[model samples]
Target: MKRSRAVSLGILGAAAFGLAACQTEEQTDAAAFSDEQSCVAAAAQSGWFTREDCAATFAEAKAVHEETAPRYESQALCEEEHGAGACGGDPAAASGGGGGSIFMPLLAGYLIGQALGGGRAMAQPVVPKAGGGFATPTGGTQLSRLNSTGKMGTTAFAKGPTTAGQPPMSRAAVASRGGFGGSAATRSVGS
Candidate 1:
């Protein structure tokens, strides 16, 4: 049946979405790992110690590094540019702008995606309905509807349009169905 096909489509779409979500998560993890590695490399180059030095210091390098961040700009810059230096080098090396290497970009992308949508799903739409009642396919949103905002010139949100081949409507009817005109900020179907 056509309804069955619709159901299948919905299921397939959801599975695909779930897979894509997993991929994005994997990418995020990879990004974080990359940052940690880069930080290690840079730290070695700047001194204030190394894997071997940490062994001598105590054997746990990560803990030492966290406590050894520089407190001065000149010291941080020196270590950053010239490679690892003495533990007493500078006070600012640890600051490193709160230490962003590669993970920040991936994390930022994920946050933006969540903000654009995702917090609210399976809700009603903002557009008038052709069936004289609110009806929208679950998880059916246009790329533009979700992503056409942000730095782009498009608006952050838009009222979706009704599908073609339906009946005419009265202004009052359209207005009433949306639960608007009451000033209570009704949450519409397509919203």
Candidate 2:
């Protein structure tokens, strides 16, 4: 009887651990701003973020945008995904020895989130979507507008795969990238 009870308790503990692992991701306070000045302005009033935090996070977001924003083989394809006037020539590709002209969406905004453990803040770059919204580089999170504040999953700050130094994506490749709603599919550049 004693051994049976111990085994039952062990099973229950394991079940509890498994359930905990399936819990939803933790949420954090986050906000979106169209630019650094706007974030700084909000920081002065909200007290959740500081001016320094705004600047640093915005810079980080810009770098992430340049590194991770999806690249297209043509302006038409990029515009199709990002909307007209929202796409631009890839700066890295234009600098020389980049193979050919590449296009990508412009950085539409930035998201700043309170770190889960309360250290420094976190940031993610947002780009314009075809239907008039904003999304992270991975298209895992979408927001309707900038200058908004709310609770967001910590995963919103996660960086997407780097597109820098990679071959530009063709229309079919972009169609199949499948990153929306966090259901990203990994595929080789040439495949």
Candidate 3:
């Protein structure tokens, strides 16, 4: 019973942390993606593209550049004058921008958690298994907690006489009479 109670508390604490983490992730994503769609839409709204003009420009530029120089000579001169970027035109240094350092630790943590089974679980209760295993507490269930009462709880499964399908708790108030868990806490009509 004590272990179950501790498990309940732990589940409650985990749930609180989960809620906080979810809220933080949502806020971070919102901040990061802000105005992204608007910027894409604005860029796409520029209706200045003509396929014929694009083709003509490409052909004219290609003819002029090719006619002006020998390809191998131009390549050798480019490599001598500038660097390898003259060939590919795109490199890590050229694509550099203002961004924080990569969080390798965070990636490692995520991978470790995934390896340790941090995802959704299978169906199982957090109690002594009927066959002799143990129940893993997923979260605290309010139905498991007794309302201020001594009764076995309406949520309790049917023993010998108690019916299985009952309400959350017995209607008879046990707190007022100052008795709990099947103690003598009777009530009269007037009081």
Candidate 4:
């Protein structure tokens, strides 16, 4: 009887651990907009956000884009990762001490998510992908289109490592670094 009870307790503990492992990430209401104007327009319809929220989040996203977007050694390499016409010379490199050879993707859009505990909305900037769609700087969250709303994991708003002042990545280095490769599971909520 004692042995049976001990085995049963062990099984229950294992089952609990399995259930915990299966738990999904926390989700929040999220929306993507191609520009600040679009976000402001949508703010009227989305009770979760306001005009002020749109302005604030858009600004925050742009700053995040400038700081965290991947930097490559050439426009061609940047374009190869981001779609053609989406690549641009790195603004920091041009203005700062970094080499002029650096390039980065243009900001395609921004994602705004309602804070889980009801604080200010969270924002993440997105850049164009090689084929189609947009992805966060870390390429951890992907969106099929802008002007769409859905539930997204809270992790989508997490900031990526800053690349602003770092040395531009060579093609081989970019491949090895892995954030811009879209390796994370694509999590698209709506169209």
For candidate 4, list the clashing residue pairs, or say none.
none
Query: Could you tell me which 10 consecutive residues in candidate 2 have the lowest summed lDDT?
Result: 1-10
- Tens digits of per-residue lDDT, candidate 3, 50-109, equal 233233333432332222211111233323222333322112222444232111000000
For candidate 2, the TM-score is 0.82
lDDT of 1 by residue, 54-145 (tens): 22322222222223221222333322322344213222222444442211000101001111232321111211112121111111221212
List residue ranges in candidate 3 displaced over 4 A.
1-44, 69-76, 85-191
lDDT of 4: 0.75
Give the poorly placed runs of model 1, Cα more than 4 Å off: 1-162, 179-191
In terms of lDDT, model 1 sits at 0.21
lDDT of 1 at 81: 20
Q: Indicate the worst ten consecutive residues by lDDT in candidate 4.
A: 1-10
Q: What TM-score would each prediction reach against the true structure?
A: 0.15, 0.82, 0.18, 0.82
**lDDT tens digits, residue span 1-191, model 4:** 00000000121121101111334556678888899999999989988999999999999999999999988888998988888899998877888764467899999999888998879999999888888878788666666677788766576787878989888889787777564644332333321
Q: Return whichever of 1 and 4 wins on lDDT.
A: 4
Which candidate, 3 or 4, has the higher lDDT? 4
lDDT score at residue 54, model 3, on the 0-100 scale:
31
Q: Judging by lDDT, tell me the better candidate of 2 and 4.
A: 4
